[model samples]
Target: MAITAPIATINDHSVRILAWNQIGSWLTYTDANGNSAIKYQFWDGGTDANSGFIWNDAGSGQLAANTTLEINAADLSQVWVRGGAAGGSETMWVRAFDGSDWGSWDSFTLTTIPNSRPVATISDHMVKFDQWTRVSNWLSYSDGDGEAATRYQFWDGGTATTSGYIWNDGGSGQLAANTTLEVAASEINNIWIRGGSAAGSETMWVRAFDGHDWGNWDSFTLTSQPNLAPVATIGDQSMHVGGWARASNWLSYSDPDGDAATQYQFWDGGSAGTSAYIWSDVAGGPQAAGTAITVAANDVSKIWIHGGSATGTDTMYVRAYDGQAWSAWDSFIVTSQNTSPVATIEDHSVHVNQWVRASNWLSSSDPDGDAITQYQFWDGGTAADSGFIWNDAGSGQQAASTAVTVAASDVSKIWLHGGAATGAETMYVRAFDGYTWSAWDSFNFTTVTNTAPVANIADHALHVNEWARVSNWLSSADAEGDTITRYQLWDGGTAGNSGYVWSDVGTGQQPASTVLEVAASDVPQIWFRGGSATGTETMYVRAFDGIDWSSWDSFTLTTTA
Candidate 1:
């Protein structure tokens, strides 16, 4: 009897089988003559199987299937299964036997599901200029078929195939452009990216592969931030009047990008503007306001500022430029400190009890150009009790450690009186500006001795009726070159004797007292008259120099009838 063709039924016919998965089918038909089915055979391709006959699941030989047989896709190899007859539509032949010859091979259709491409997505990211950043968290992929992504590609620009790099798990370096690179499942999360030298928005394309096909190219924007401006800070500065302050010592700068200051600007006041003055030299000579000074980054320490003419505090504003942008203005306090006046005194020589002029011994100068208003003197140096200073008019004397207000014109009138003791003597002096006093300056001098003058006179003869000039014998001299100021003539050794000295005027001989005083020019006009007895009369004469008097001199006058 003829066995009817065995009919084949699949457990889930509508469902498509994934590649490399096994599919099972069952036969439900009865033989026409009621024969029991015993054996089965399967073939690939068509019902009339030829060289494409189905092999055993172990790939050993032809397969003899029972009512149900598991078609092992693993045996077909992924290539044959994936390359189905018509775009994944595969055909298989199956037949059943009823203890007799096998029925005609039945054809059934099987479909190999295509692998779903992993969807690659990338989110926008931000990066600093010239910095390397990671792109793992910014990239993502998904596959509907539960497949893991195995490879990834990156491109600098929007296009993927033009020029791109692939991640190399071996760290041997990036693969060639558009080159597919295999990676471990864990390595897919460690992608890295870097931006170019320029700072701006950048676009790139990325894709992932799940062993089968590459996903669509995903684009992401890389925003590179611009270079940051430098920050500037300034510290307070202190300098003496007429001194200089360097900007580099007080002004400092820093940048987040490590950029150096390339240019600098300076202002005189607390704010930046061109209204005030800023000197460039120590002398406070050349000056400018709110101007930019060109300088090398490494030479910023050379910038200098002048502490102006006056003593007090001043403010200065400054800023720096870093190729990209200028930093904010910073300020520093410039303290112009006061400078004390310098005092000086010169050594002098004077006689004992002589008066010395302040102008010849004391002087001072102030660096800040302040006036020297007052002077104070004290006994100092090798010898104490050197001298004493007098008030403005020399009317009153002042002791040591006293301040005297002597005007410039009165400097010559203010006297320093020499002490009673004679020898090398010293006195200290100091000058005072309007604000401060200078250190003590020493004044040194030597006291000398003075000598008296000498008087020379001769005895004269006089006639009773005839006048005799007695002044012709009078003469005087001094050892110190002092002029003879006055002269005294007497008769009885002292001024108490009777009248014997006389002066002859144009009218007649005037009877003068025993003592006679005359100026130095009148000494030649004196006339002496003898007494009535007239034998030997004595006259005493003396001369006076400006500082000391000469000893007494004697002269005798005689009268003849």
Candidate 2:
């Protein structure tokens, strides 16, 4: 029986294949007679059956009618199926024979699936100076074909892949421009990046390949952080009062970025906001800052604390600044030691047996502004000398060293007596603050010799039987300014003789005894009568002070008839 050409149909119509990949399909043909044998021919390209080769597989010759056969592209040379364009149609010609007649070649086409390009995306990343960071951590990739990347390119600043670097699956090494490398997708995670010597923002480009085509160039910003701030440290320190507390003595600076400190600030208390007092000068009077003081790093020692006024403990805060930013605040203890007071004394002169106030020759001052609360007096330069310190009234006295509190009303009224011995003497004094005593201050005390008084009498001329005033005839003078306390008059040159000494009784002068004594106020009222003999009669008179008596003087009284 004559049979029409078997109708050619493909069993798997939706099957898609890649270039150079193997694909299996089932071929079915229709035959009218059940006993008719079927044969098929398969070829690729050219017109139907004129330009391609015939398939000679075991299943190519079919015996039964309406039978199915399996066809695989792996059986053909790789170049046969690879001739079609990517993601385009590939044609295969097939014809069937029903034992006697062969039908025109029937064509069946299969589509080649194109490979999806791997998409690469990179986000902006932050890098610190001199710090290394992983480049892959900021990169992501996707492939629609579920293929892994086989190659990678990195651009330092631009999207020119030929001028950038490449990495391979074996290891990371420098690759020439316009070069290719075979690298696994997992190996790309080893990529790392580090900021250069300078710190700033820059752009970088990257692309990945999925063994076929490279993805579009993806860019990202790599911002480098600024330099690190300096580190500040301070140690506790101790200083005496009236001394400056310098920052260089305790503060230290360091920086991880290798930068030096440019400026610094200081606070009085433990914290910067603790607006306390800090002085820049040794006087510490008006050059004070209640908040903070900022100065150059070179002048670190110029910054002084406020401990000069008094003695105690103080807390100070300090910080340093690099070219970029300031460091954290650091605190330290400033211990102010106590300072003793200073004593001073002046030389003094006094008369013998005179009492002088010791406090008048003694004075003191303290550098720490502490008050002089007490005083100690000594007879000599040292505290072990024997000297008398008398009370204000000169009633009570203490030998050698003696101390008195400032609270006493007469504390500074200390009395010292100049003894009868006339010469130079030394006295020592010391002042005490609340803390300690000052060094002894010695002073010279000189005593002057006493001089005796001089007695004088002018010669008196009076008529016989006439009473002339003798008050003006007797006068006294002293070199030491001593007052005349007593007077002696004699009729002759002997001190025991008393003549012309009269007493007033009952409104008239009466004859008096050979000797008479009277008060100094009554000396002016003494009246002397002319002696019976008018010739020159020598009368001697003398004056006496409390300490010494003056020499005797003589005067002549003349009577005329």
Off by over 4 Å in 2: 1-199, 203-224, 227-305, 308-317, 320-352, 359-374, 380-387, 393-395, 405-412, 420-426, 432-436, 443-561
What C-alpha lDDT do the candidate models reach, one value each?
Answer: 0.61, 0.61
Q: Which ten residues in a row have the lowest lDDT in candidate 2?
A: 46-55
- For residue 444, model 2's alpha carbon misses the true position, in angstroms, by 6.4
Each candidate structure's count of clashing pairs: 0, 0
lDDT digits (tens) for residues 200-295 of candidate 1:
665677788887778888877766676688887788877765666667777778988787788777666622231223554333344455445555
Spell out the clash pairs found in candidate 1.
none
- Give the winner by TM-score: 1
TM-score (C-alpha) between model 2 and the true structure: 0.35
lDDT of 2 by residue, 133-236 (tens): 56566778888988878777777662333222323334655444334433456677666666544556667777898777888888787666766878898888
Model 2 residue pairs with clashes: none
